[model samples]
Target: MTTLMEKAHAGVVTSEIKRVAASEEVNAETVRKLLADGFLVIPKNINSKSEPIGIGKLMRTKINANVGTSRDNVDIETEVEKARTAEKYGADTIMDLSTGGDLDLIRRRIMDAVSIPVGSVPIYQAAGESIGNMSSDDMFNAVRKHANDGIDFVTVHAGVTQSSFERLKRSDRILDVVSRGGAFTISWMKHNCMENPFYSEYDYLLEMAREYELTLSLGDGMRPGCINDASDRAKFEEFIILGELVKRAREAGVQTLVEGPGHVPIDEIGLSVTAMKHLTGNAPLYLLGPLVTDIAPGYDHITAAMGGAVAGMHGADFLCMTTPSEHLALPDVADIREGTIVTRIAAHAADLTKEGVREKAREADRRMAVARRELNWNRQFGCAIDSEKAKMIHARSRNADTCSMCGELCSIKMMREVMKK
Candidate 1:
């Protein structure tokens, strides 16, 4: 069985590529060429039996919603509801980061509930079990189990090597290590006086990913935690290793996506995207928030959306949403909706920078302008990404001919009336 990359290399267009192209509004041949060249990835494991989603160059920006239970919360039904809600609100992909309850059952239930591609970080399970006793074999087994369970992709932090840890130690930053998986691996490696299992045995992991046709999202284990830590030695060092691993994975017939920073300032976001693209040879760059600010705890979703919009516009292929629950606790249904919708807004905003995406957005905006001029509040609300929110907000102002904020000063209506004379 040819992997997507292998099939692209062989000049055969896979069904996944066609489906992705159609969804992304790109030429099938274009997606094929990008896949063949390792510049794009369509992460749909052959065993997944889920709808394929594309992430990479020249495609519309994609958003991924992280849903799952932590040690504190472990209700499978609630997690499943979150998954369904994520899909409903427009998450192109979902990652099950459940570290609590029956891990396998949670994953299976989430996968069963949604048709979108589902991903998982296997190390979470490995670390969850023994906490301190998990060996390299334990980590490997966890990965194999996820693959066998048909996870579309697995985020393997195969970049944090012994040498990288040395750099991390030598160069301190505001946030030493922001990634949960990275912290787990680094602690284990330091305690065991050994290298990270995922780093040391990456090929073995790649072979497993290949057998199941799973894409490896090279996790940014040393991602910056604050603006002060953005793009420091530890972050770049891990990226260098990730670049090498990406080449190795593609060579071995496994798809790969490169994960990026945690918290980055507005000014540094574009550079981070460019650096990751250059380092990973343009393999789909999946970024987490690159959260522009550290101060907004309850409103990290907005911060993430702001950063996600910039990252996507600059070159980040996939945006991982930071829910309102981020830095606090697990999100409920409302948080899920808020996070997904905000991230979608970011994705669409970024899409405007793409070739035809602006035209689409401009068309919508034009319709909005016309709607306001005609006092068509229904059309104005209908054109909104969150129509329910728009309707509610509009209704709260007594359904005024003009929005409450600018009621008597409605620009379009005023301008039209002035022009009529």
Candidate 2:
């Protein structure tokens, strides 16, 4: 059987690409070209019957919600609810970074519950107990376990090689090695006095990926943690390795997505995405918050959206939504809903700027313009992305047609009345 990449190369549009194009409201050939060029990827394992979700260039920017349990918080029920909340609010995908009790069961249950593409970082399970005991074999076994369980995508920290560590030692960043997976791999390398197994034994990983047809999310282990650490030596060194791994993976017939920066200042986000695209040859870039500011603990979602909009508009393919619970605690159901909606808004805003991106958002904005001209509250709500929230907040304001901020002297409403003949 031909992989999606092969089928695409042969000019055969697979069902996955077709579905993605239909969802994005673009031509299937556009999607096929993106896939062939390694700009877009449909993460669906061969053995798994899960539906495909596209992430990359020339498509609607997709958002992914991270839902999992920490050791202190191990409620499978709550995680499932968060997953459901994410789906309801508009998360294109979900990554189960579970490290708590019953890791395998939690993942399987989440997969069964959600129709969206599911992703997992296998190293989390390998190093869940302690970073000391996490050997290469442990990591490999965990990835295979995830593949056997039908995870649509697996994040492998294959870029944090020994050479990258050498680069990190000379650099002085505010938060050195903020990625948990990167920390684990670096610790393992220092302890064993050996090279990174993921880099050394990449073919074995590629074979596993090819067998399951799993999309390898080449994890950004050396990504900057703080705004000061953005675009440092450690980050680029790992990226060079990731680019090589991406070329090799494509040769092995396995799909790939390149994970990107941890946190970056607003001005630097564009440069970060552009550099990654140039280095990695435009492979799908999945970014964390790339949070613009260091402050705003409770409003990281807003901070993330600010940066995400820039990243998506520049070149990023996927936006990982940061909840209000970010840098604090595990997000509950409400947090997931808010995070997903906020990120979706960011993605849509960015899509408007991107060439040949989503049309619905722009069309909705056009409808809202018409509604404001006609003084139609119902139409305004109908055109809103979060109509329920808009309606509820408006209802609490004491003004039926006008919000409390504007009241009876609403400019738009007043303008409509004055302009009427």
Candidate 3:
């Protein structure tokens, strides 16, 4: 089975490259080169009906909205709606992290609901029999199942091995492990008295990936759970391992994306990003919030957006949306919408600073600036990321042209008059 990366390396630009090139506004050669070098990835499974999305170098920093059913809350329809809602609100992709209610059905329904690429954590399902009962086969089986179901990418916490576990024990971490998949892998290893199957038998995983043309997302299993635990030895240890795994995957022609730390302070984000990129040879860096702070539980979405923008500026290629209910409960459709839009804003904000795509991103801002300056409400709405919301908020104003905040005292309006002279 020839994978896209292998094809690219062989100097064959497939249709996927052509489509992504047109969408990202880069020439097909650029995408091909980046994919061949393992610096970018297009996570399209052979069976996936979803349109291809290019992630990594020279592409717009993308947003992923996670929709899934919790054990306490299992509504297939709701989960599917959440997926659609996220896509409608500008999420670049969706990850079905469901741990409840007929996982296969929930996963398939979510995929059918959206045209964007879908991703998942296979170990979550493997742990359905409880952590203690999961055999190594269970883990691999779940991965193969999801891949067969057209999961474009899968987050395999292959870094959480016996070696990394030793480092974690040496480190004095407060939250210890916040990643459920990481916790599961560690627990299973401790119980079975063997190394993580994903690591010990990584060649097998790579074989399956190549067979399915799957993109491996090297999960940051030991990622910092809070700012206090940010960039610790354990985290870096995992990065080192993931870096090795990334090279192995590339050699096998299986495209890969490296996931980064979830909770990091604003000051240290650059360091975390740089280290991960360096260690992993700059494989497409997919990041969870890297939420700057842990105290704002309810407004974690905003907290994450603040951190996401900074992380993107520092070379994060993808930002996973965090909702207001992030630290609370299963997010509904409304939460998904809010989170997707907020994360998209952060991605766009970062694009304004990123290379290769900055000028194109800036041109969009220029259009909005001109619209605002001319007080073209309709044009301004047209340029908005969420024109419906913009129009709604603008409709609240007593003045027809300017918004309620400044009204007739609007700076743009005043500036327009000033410029006329």
**Candidate 2 at residue 71, lDDT?**
92
Model 2 segments beyond 4 Å from truth? none
Which residue pairs collide, candidate 1? Answer: none
lDDT of 2 by residue, 217-308 (tens): 99999898888888988999889889999999888777899999888998888888998988888899999877898789999999999999
Query: In candidate 3, how many Å is residue 5 off?
Result: 0.8
Q: Give the TM-score of candidate 1.
A: 0.96
True-structure RMSD, every candidate: 1.6, 1.5, 1.0
- Which regions in candidate 1 have their CA more than 4 angstroms from the true location? none
Give the alpha-carbon lDDT of every model.
Answer: 0.88, 0.88, 0.93
Q: Order the numbered candidates by TM-score, best leading.
A: 3, 2, 1
What are the clash counts of all predictions, listed in order?
0, 0, 1
Q: lDDT of candidate 1 vs native?
A: 0.88
Best by TM-score: 3
Candidate 1 residues 1-421, lDDT tens each?
6677888989988898999889878889998998888778888877788998778887778899999998888899999999999999899999999999999999999999999999999999998666589888988999989989989999988898899899999986867997888988898988899988888878898878878888899999999888888889888988889999988988887889999988989998888888888988888999998799999999999999999999988888799988998989889978999999999999888887865456766677789878877988899888888898988877878636877787787787788888995
Instruction: Give lDDT: candidate 2, residue 33.
Output: 80
